[model samples]
Target chain A: MLEARDLACLRGERVVFAGLSFRLEPGGALLLVGANGAGKSTLLRLLAGLLRPEAGALLWDGADALADRAAHAARIRYLSHQDALKPALTARENLHFFAQLWGGEVAAALDALDLLPLAELPARVLSSGQKRRLALARLGLSDPARRAPLWLLDEPTVGLDAASVGKLGALLARHRAAGGMVLAATHLPLPMPGAGELRL
Target chain B: MALLARELRLALRHPADTLAAVLFFVLVAALFPFGVGPAPETLARLAPGALLAAALLAALLPLDRLFGADAEDGTLDQLLLSGLAPPAVALAKAAAHWLTTGLPLLLATPVAAAMLNLPVEAWGAAMAALGLAAGFLSLLGTAGAALTLGARRGGVLLPLLVLPLAIPAVIFGAAGIEAAASGLEARPYLLLLAALLAAALPLAPLAAGAALRVE
Candidate 1:
């Protein structure tokens, strides 16, 4: 389980959000909704241990996760606006490189996102939606030992088509069913059951 | 180790970026004769300074792209969070930068040295100094590149930040070559270059890695 307490974020000189607190249990989903610049992304980054909050503690089952970032990062996948891909390499190569780095199941990641056909295509030629899916494919790269990993996704549905969106919803459902937890920031409504909803 | 291989692979995909730095190094060295009015006596006299300064400038040319490309594309952040030590990533990047840019400069130096009328005896010393200077510059440059990773006008800011740090290497390199030209021992200056390399090897990566961690 992941937990945030009395969280606060300051971007530049402005306070984006403050006094935010939440808990995510096994098989749970937390949906964050906000207008543009409402600090949804900021909060997710904090949860992913990407951004340090001005005031708060991120606890993993009562212990501070911040104190051990490498171990924490190994358990979570943070998907943001950028896909972290090389345009010159094909999709498979990109995924393969990440798997080598992160210890993921590459073939299943592609299958989960239905990206096998586009696997050999260079990322430069991929459409925006395809690129987004490719990024989503990373979530599938989790190791078999950790079938129920945490996902920190920011606007993950931005350019996804309807069919891809369904695939995403299904992926989430399956993941949550297996005791995985998700903390997502999105404007699009998703079919997530029994999810904790928060508006920043 | 994996990160270093990945960096090399990415660099391999963009051969043009690596070649551009080498071409710039050669072209700039080639122009020294015309700019300084090609008299062999004067060229030999000016060769040490010319070679060192040109190599310094050429090394600076690629520093901007060192972190800019990865930062823009978001791979830098992923690398930082990839469970490898941040310092390890920074060091791997420095290794790749040195291999692609610095090695080429070393290879081109012999021809440039000949063209500039450097004494035959000084050629070996010059190459040694330059080889050390290349490693030193790559080490120092990676820190500057990491410091300016996501800033606006990073290209313009890089040289201003790095050149001051490079003066020691420049001095030792040029002075060493000049010493060899006069039949003097260049060992002292070469030792200083090695010391600089030693100091920079451990520290540069730590500094660059810290800069990369700034969120």
Candidate 2:
């Protein structure tokens, strides 16, 4: 289980959030909901180990998660607002780089997002939604048998269409069913069923 | 390394950055002959200084893009999260920058040296010095790039940050070539250049990595 206790965060000089707490178990999903400046993204970043909490502790299986950040980072797949793509690289090459870094099947990840048809195209030419799908393809690169346990997504559905959103929902379901966890920050209704909500 | 391979592939696809630096190196050296009037003795005397300056300035051209592009597109985040220690990320970038930008500058040094009317005998010494100079600049530039990342007018700030630190390499590189040109042993100057590179090889990336780790 992953748990946060009395978490607090500061962005610039302002306190974005404080006294925040949440728990995520194996095969669980949590949706972070709040208006702009509500610290949803900040919370996701904090949980992902990208940002350090000003106060409180993050525990994984009852151990301090932040104590070994590389180990904590190894278990997460974070998708930020930007697509994290090289515009000059072809879509397959883009996914291939990440696959090489994290150990996954590039072709399978591409197919998961139905991106095989556009695999040869440069990412610069991809539509905004397609680019988002390519970024989403990274999550599918995880090995089914040795998946990273936690996924932290920020505005994951921002540019996705209904069809792609459904595809993503299936991906999320498979992950949760396999004892993986998800914490997605979104203003729009996601296809996650039986997921809990955390309003910042 | 995956990051190195990606950086090389990206460099190949967008060869403009590498090309512009090489072209600038040659052009800057070529301009010295025009401005100083093409007297062989005068040109030869100015060759070492002129060549070193052009190479350093050309290398500076690409420093701003070193970490800027990755940070802007969120690639730096993925790199940070890749579980590769942040120092390794900076080191890989420095290696790639040296291959694409630094190697090209070294290759073009001969043409620039010829344009400056440098003695044929000094060509070897000049190439050696330039090679070390390129490597030193690559490490220094990587650190500078990381430091200036996310800053306003980073382009303007990059040279200002890098050029001062580069003076030692410039002095050693030019002196090494001048020593060899006058039939003197250039070992001390060359060794100093190598010492600077050796120090930077570990420290520059460490500094760059620390800067990158800052949220």
Query: lDDT winner among the candidates?
Result: 2
In model 1 chain A, the worst 10-residue window by lDDT is: A140-149
- TM-score, prediction 1: 0.95
- Quote the RMSD, in angstroms, for model 1: 1.7
Docking class of 1: medium
Tens digits of per-residue lDDT for model 2, B1-215: 88999999999999999999999999999999899999999999999989999998998888898999988899888888888998899999999999998899888888999999998899999999988998998998998999999899989998999899999999999999999999998889999999999999999999999999885
Q: Which TM-score value belongs to model 2?
A: 0.97
TM-scores for every predicted model: 0.95, 0.97
Interface RMSD values for the candidates, listed in order?
A: 1.2, 0.8
Q: After superposition, how far is residue B146 of candidate 2 from its true place, in Å?
A: 1.2
Q: Tens digit of lDDT per residue, candidate 1, span A40-129?
A: 988877877778889888889999988888888777888877888889988998898888877777778898989999999999999999
Flag clash pairs in model 1.
none
lDDT of 1 at A54: 93
